[model samples]
Target: MLELACISKTFNPGTVNEKKALSGVALRLEKGDFVTIVGSNGAGKSTLFNAIAGAFYVDEGAIRLAGEDITFKPEYKRSREIGRLFQDPMRGTAPHMTIEENLALAYLRTAKNQNAFFSRTSKAEKQFFRDRLALLDMGLEDRMKQPVGLLSGGQRQALTLLMATLVPPKLLLLDEHTAALDPSTAEKVLGLTREIVAEHHITTMMVTHNMKNALELGNRTLMMDSGRVVLDIGGEERKGLTVEDLLKRFKAGAGRELDNDRILPSE
Candidate 1:
């Protein structure tokens, strides 16, 4: 459902501090493919995700979603086809809005009538929101009237996930969505991620620093280094691999062991 071809991005180009964030990065995803990406700092993992999300224009290459070339499309223009969850728990939702209000905004994405206010929830819409929230089983339905600011980190991220998938975009970009949560909560959120992705059959790319998570979730695993994809493994091969095996591959591909402290396996 998504394809990136020979994408490259450079910051402060032609200057002494010129840093290439992405170098000829190419990737393709089928309709329901879930991909987990891992890399050390400055490996271009997040850069690639941001590029696909249209956060900024790439210096070279093309981005296509479901056969539409969106390389030159503005960020807002691509929002209809993409859903993103950032690393920060606070980044995805409006704190002052009630839980239901936030969901109302997301539901608006698929609305045929532009004049309608998502917050003006009809009985039918309310029921729909309630049914969706029930899937989280987080008692969010009861707290629909509560402001999102009052929610815990995990709750906010879970709500963000719900928002991202509400419309079933052509591609979902998860940039360390569970990074800021506590261990137990992160686990719960990860489980929710798997459930939601499977149910919706949405194409997804998840960037994570945790090796175990990179290996455990998603249909494919990609390792990046120095602004390029150094390794890609998936399906039965990835399923049979261990953390140590991934480390070995990283070392072989990058000619050095991954040294990022955050890339270590979670105990």
Candidate 2:
């Protein structure tokens, strides 16, 4: 449901600090497809997401979502069709907002209610938020009145995931969302991610620093190096893939041994 055509981006152009972040990077995702990405530092994984999210304009090429060209759309405008989660749990939610209040904002994405989100919610809407929070199984439904800052990192990220996908955008972008969580919590969040994405049939692209997560979580896996996608694998070829196998492919595509320095170990 998403396509990137020969996209490129460069920062600090024409100076010694000039660096190419994305080079003719082209990618496509089918409806309900979940693709995982892995790469070393400065591999353009996050840059690719930023480009799709409209954090900045691409230097060249085009981006289309569900057949609509949104290359020049501003971030707020594009947000109507895209949901994003960042590595930092604190980035998605307003720390001072209560759980239900945060969810109310997310619900507003698909909500036609012109009233301010902070205004009293209807009984049905409050119930809906409660039900959604209950799915996290974190007792957050009962703590809807508590500020988000009171939640643990894992709980906040779980809440963030719910907020991001609450309305099911045309595309979901997760950028190392679980990287900061503890092992058990990370696994829990990953499981929740899969369940939510599947239930909504949301097409997703997740950039992960965990090698095994890249191979294990999604239907397809992509490897990048020096701002380019060097390896892409999926379908039958990806069913039984392992980290060692991916390392081999990375070496072949990147012309060097895979760098494990930045990759998180499997839990």
Candidate 3:
């Protein structure tokens, strides 16, 4: 459903701080593929997602979603084809908006009729929102009138997840989505992630620093270093592997051990 062909990106070019973020990086995902990505700082994990999401255009190469080129599309134009949840829970939702209002916005995002008016709370919309929110089992339905700013970090993240997947875009990009939550909350969010992805059969690419999560969540796991992907493991081979085995493979493939600081312990 998504393809990145020979993509390359560089930051601060022609300056002292010049750094290459992607170097001829290429990736392809079939419909319903769930790929987990892990890499240390400066490994271009976020850069790759940004490139695909059109946060910024890549220095060179083409990106296609569902067989259409979107390399030069602006971020907002690409929103219809992609769903993203950022590292910060606070970044995804509007602080001043009520829970129901936030969901209304997402619903409007996928609305086909351009002439329809947007509402903060329609009975039909509220019913749909309540059903979706109930999946989190977090009593969000009871707080639809509350400002999103009042929610806890985990609650906000859960709400963000629902908002992102409400319409089932062509691709889902999760960039360190649970990194800011507490261990228990992170685990809960991760489980929610798996459940939603599986239920919808969405094509997802998740960037994570947690080794165990990378190894456990997706159908395939990729390890990146510097500006390129160095390791790809999947299928029966990756099914029973542990964190230590993944680290060893990363070191052998990248010619360097996995950075200790980036390998989050199992929570």
Candidate 4:
């Protein structure tokens, strides 16, 4: 569903504080592929995501999604085809807006309707939002009029997840969507993520710090380092792999052990 060819990106080029964030990184994902990425800090995990999300143009690369070239597409334009969620629960939402309002904006924006910005939600659309929110099992359907700011961290994150997939974009990028919450809440959000993705068969890429969750949650796992993808494992090979096995593989591929000592076995 997505393809990247020779993707390379650098920051502050030709300066004292220069850093290459991505180096000839190439990857491909088929439809409904759930890809989980784990890497130590400065490994270009987020940069790869930003590159795909059109946060910045890659120095040299071509990005194609569902057979369309979006290499130079503006971030706003890509939003129609790509759905993204960040570590911070507050990032994707308008804190002062009611839950229903937030859902409406996301719905209209991706609906690709020319009248999206000016259109008002009909009673039927409001009902649709309520039904979708109800699927979160968070009591948000009844609280549609409540400001998003009133929700707890997990609740808002769940709401954000709902908004992102309300229309099932061609691709979904999750940048540690649950990393900011407590373990229990994080687990709940992760469960919601699994269900939503499966329901729509959304092709997804999730960047996570927990090695255990990385291995357990997705169909494929990618290990990245020094701005390049060092390892990609999936299917039968991935089913037999454990966290320690993954670590050893990373060491072999990256020529160095992963640097993050605080990486735990579980979320």
Number of the top lDDT candidate = 4
lDDT-best of 1 and 2: 2
For model 2, the stretches where C-alpha displacement exceeds 4 angstroms are: 111-120
Each model's lDDT: 0.90, 0.91, 0.90, 0.92
Q: Which 10 consecutive positions of candidate 3 have the poorest summed lDDT?
A: 112-121
TM-score of each: 0.96, 0.96, 0.96, 0.98
lDDT of 2 at 60: 99
Error of model 4, residue 1, in angstroms: 0.6
In order of lDDT, best first, we have: 4, 2, 1, 3
Task: List the pairs of residues colliding in candidate 1.
Answer: none
Candidate 2 C-alpha lDDT tens digits along 216-256: 88799999999999999999999887788888889999999
Which lDDT tens digits does candidate 3 get at residues 147-205? Answer: 99999999999999999998888899999999999989998999999999998999999
Query: Rank by TM-score, descending?
Result: 4, 1, 2, 3
For model 4, the superposed segments whose C-alpha errors exceed 4 Å read none
RMSD for each model, in Å, please? 1.2, 1.4, 1.4, 1.1
- Candidate 1 Cα misplacement greater than 4 A, ranges: none
Q: How much is the lDDT of residue 226 in candidate 4?
A: 95
Question: Which pairs, if any, clash in model 3?
Answer: none
Model 4 lDDT per residue over 1-267, tens place? 999998999999999989999999999999999999999989999999999999999999899999999999999999998999999998999999999899989888776557666148999989999999888888899999999999999999999998899889999999989889998999889999999999999999999989998899879999999999999999999999988999999999999999897577653
Residue-pair clash count for candidate 3: 0
As a TM-score, model 1 comes out at: 0.96
Q: What's the count of clashing pairs in each model shown?
A: 0, 0, 0, 0
